[model samples]
Target: MNDATTSPADSALATRGAALDLLFNVLAKRVPFDDAWDASRPLRALEPRDRAFVRMLVATTLRRLGQIDAAIQGSLNKQGQQLKAVVQDILRLGAAQLLFLGTPAHAAVDTAVELAVARKQHPYKGLINAVLRRLDRERASILAEQDAGRLNTPDWLWLSWRKTYGTALTRAIVETHLGEAPLDITVKANAAAWAERLEATVLPTGSLRRAAGGQVTELSGFDEGGWWVQDAAAAIPARLFGDLAGRDAIDLCAAPGGKTAQLAAAGAQVIAVDRSEKRLVRLSENMARLGLGARVTTVAADATEWRPDAVVDAVLLDAPCSATGTIRRHPDVARLKSEEDVEKLGRIQSRLLYRAVDMLKPGGTLVYCTCSLQAEEGESQITNLLYRRPEMQVVPVTADEVGGLSELLTPDGYVRCTPGHLAEIGGMDGFFAARLRRVG
Candidate 1:
């Protein structure tokens, strides 16, 4: 009998199970799982449940990587850093299911053993089974005594948070990321109409937050081009433009077009520019879906090397940074980012801001934003730019612009949102945004 004629459900299970394994492999190599999601081909055909399972596996493993490794080490007699990558990934996945997820002990061990056999790593399956069984027996004491910070995060990151936000706030921030993030949607035109149509709760900033799991494209009004998925915090910088109807706007580094969609929806003639041809494909698709293609023009060029045909009325530079702010949504961020990487990203952010200011028309707004929690990337970057460019004036965002988030706004009128700030209401991502005007 030909294996190709197998039942569809069996084939799907095999594919999804393999994708989960691949996801774990990529994550064990320290590559970010979400960014890897865009690159991995195995996950493309997975059902939503399996996809969610794979995501949960990668996220829980990364969130508790330190603790998971500790648990593995504690259970092993001969712990070596040079273990085979496949073996390591299998052990981590099994441990994650056994300890973090409520997966039954037998299912976790048996499935992991089957996976190991399929991958030709059977000699170590016994090792995997023994370790996981021990984890089950010691679950209560192991979890009770685990240091929250050390178990959940790297020592340097936990220490940095402690120094920056104090112990209580830092603990809250970590706890917030431990939970899943809600899906926030930005409506195209009428918020009330879309909210009613989709049965989603309308947030104060006009974004919609769904409970947790659902088919996004199948949601009501998605096919009608009613709205797009965007975090409430991510929508703020574009809204700072207020009324941009018929105005020319430039969105720098605008691939995958969340901010570009916001600008085009506001009636701005937007030129969305980014360096990557691959990412621009997704941006083009998003614009087509929303029927905003006419208002937005896609350009493939580096912001540093490309110049606009003419200065625009406004420019929004969503500069790249360490992206620590979005850890709740993309938990892989904490595992992949290092302190040295932040310093390098800060330099790039400074360069992007310098080029953005030069490309702005006089009296035009320049909104600078980043999904980073560090002061070096937010306040200090803006402060340094202010000294270098005397012609630019800090255009403070008003209470009306932030829509009841005025307290989160800095005294200088910049918006500074942290994970700890919105902890009670499902927690918001950390983002910093500042609007400036070119006066000369």
Candidate 2:
């Protein structure tokens, strides 16, 4: 409710307060941060630089909420016990700027106090000023002492990863999410050429990796559809069906059409099926932009209920799961998702995988994958399906097929790409995929 003032100082303070409004929208109201940001009237009215700052403020706070809260509580000593909610929000925002974002200490403190006054919590101005000043002085020591990986991660997710991946590797996954995710693009063709043109580094899997910061639309190959943004791990499932030229491949649960585009680009007659018509619109538009719309038949229907008139040669079942693996890109996954949701999603994934299997032709390949760290959603589902379907059997993914990223392959021949796998080359999303064939 802060009024914007003409002075630069008041404007900066108002923008920071607006960032807090976004944070409250997410943490208090349970709104997804992206949705909140998109609908933010205040943010939309800002200049480009201020808009970017608002985004950074909110994202950095969410990404480091645990750390910021810990730092604030530590600074408050016993006085923190009865702090007002608005006061807490202001302090958290201030600490994020000072400890993590490297904002000038005086500016951070000044703006935070100003934010408190504007929020009508004028009584807490001195408390906000004192706590933030103290935090700035002890920021280094506080940071060193705290386990930010544990702090930033939700308790449930942290425990799940620790139980699933063990202590050290789970720590690595948590640590990875703290940093910004890099941008990786799947080119239409000539991966090397596109990489050179975009000034990016080509990953072993052939996806191009560029620096983490930028406007994706401004990139060289975006408008021409020469390439599309696809994570290195995500780009793998479609590639599993190597040389799809002339093959009829169905991408079940396909939306936003990255894999569909890849299948079409590979010369496959692609039928992209998804339940959400809204997302299919996006997929259709993306296909049009890439000039691959002709090959892609967009089907807006549920994969479990929609049957192809005839069995297809290959199927890519990117079944929806908890999406825990994509935490690096969507920090909301850690905040918004829960254990019960994972259980529910696991069931849905099972149903979809079953349907995808039924649509596969005799000797056709079915590549089942999920961007999930839980075995119940990934490996366990595959095990259950194989036990139930006598005709279905595992078709091992090869290191040669996946650009010699052999480290991602499991003993049973599934590809399990994790954030820990390619540490030196940024990292890939955590994904579990099994290639299957109908032997009967």
Candidate 3:
């Protein structure tokens, strides 16, 4: 993808080349898009605008992959014989442009054909050209034929949502995932002032919401480290602990620390622990950026086996799961994760839940949360926790605590914020959180 290219056309072509390669890895190898992009030399070499384009191209291809494939397959002449995965990927990139991104037919098609040649997929050049042209010419009809809400989402996710949330709510959730999530920030101080200064909406829970896209680091307060990007929904679990002034709190599984930052900012003496040393370093750096380094300590240890020297006042285990709740922000989740992944993550979540409660002082709070829509990862964890640990009892998240938003709470009073919640104000991540007390 990198070459001695100066002309605008050549640069754009090279950008598409990078995108094609990135898309191939994500689709063919099941590599996470962010990881693939981080590891891509050509993408890094491109100018910022080109880099953005490449990212958009691949993300859009993955996001609308089902629809994109439909357009390509419907255009194919042969019924049974299918294009190679790489060839289908090229057409997907082109179709994503023509069908969704508003990329001009000539530019999208020509560059995709070039990408075919670059990827040594030149044999299917005419096929790529033909499929893309037909998609462009019949974009409206092809679009009309698509059930994007149903088609784009994986069967496992769709069925799970339907079974859990029911067909109507599931529709709302999947349709919402089709779009990109907006930016939400938790300001270190003066949320109203930051909201006004940033021209962002102050969400009821105090996280500032802004339509502002592009580089978050370029934003005004970012350099000053006044705020950190955290979804309004993702901000909930951290707030459940209330004022942690002088209290010792542990953010079990904290990395790229958002909740850990919240705990520290709330005047808690926070220990942010994660198994990955490299991730802990990143979290420490981000903490420094926010000027909360003094209040926080970083620990690189497997939380399952690691325990605090003494039981602390609070423990927040945002146990990792399928992450199906944050699909709007990370579209790759729908493709990257499977049912088996959820089952495996459930086992880990259970282990982490037990470890988290063990690290909590008696009568102290332990908040267990996950960014997953799956029942096994959310509700079931709490049920099992109560059954296994006779010392523990559900504290039941109250509506008053979450900005008087009762809908954010489930019937059993655990916090269950889904994509359908706050739909009028651009929905939040699908997050489930429960606060428990060690009654023993």
Best lDDT among the predictions, by candidate number: 3
lDDT per residue (tens digit) for residues 1-440 in model 1: 11656665455445436555555645666666656777766666666566667777777777777778888888887775456777777777778888889878877777777777878887888887888898888877877877755577777678877886679877877888777788888988888888888787787777887766778888887878879998888888899988999999999999889999999999999999999999999999999999999999989998877899898899999988888989888777887788998899998999999999888888989999998888788988999999999988898888777768675688888998777766676777888999999997
- What is the descending TM-score order? 3, 2, 1
Best by TM-score: 3
lDDT of 2 by residue, 90-147 (tens): 8888998999899999899999888887889988888898899999888889999999
- As for candidate 1, its clashing pairs are none
Which window of ten consecutive residues has the lowest lDDT sum in model 3? Answer: 1-10
When 1 and 3 are scored with lDDT, the better candidate is 3
Clashes of each: 0, 0, 0
TM-score against native, each model: 0.91, 0.95, 0.97
CA deviation > 4 Å runs, candidate 3: 1-5
Provide the RMSD of all predictions against the true structure, rounded to 1 decimal.
Answer: 2.9, 2.2, 1.4
Q: What is the lDDT of candidate 3?
A: 0.88
In model 3, the number of clashes is 0
lDDT of residue 410 for candidate 2: 85
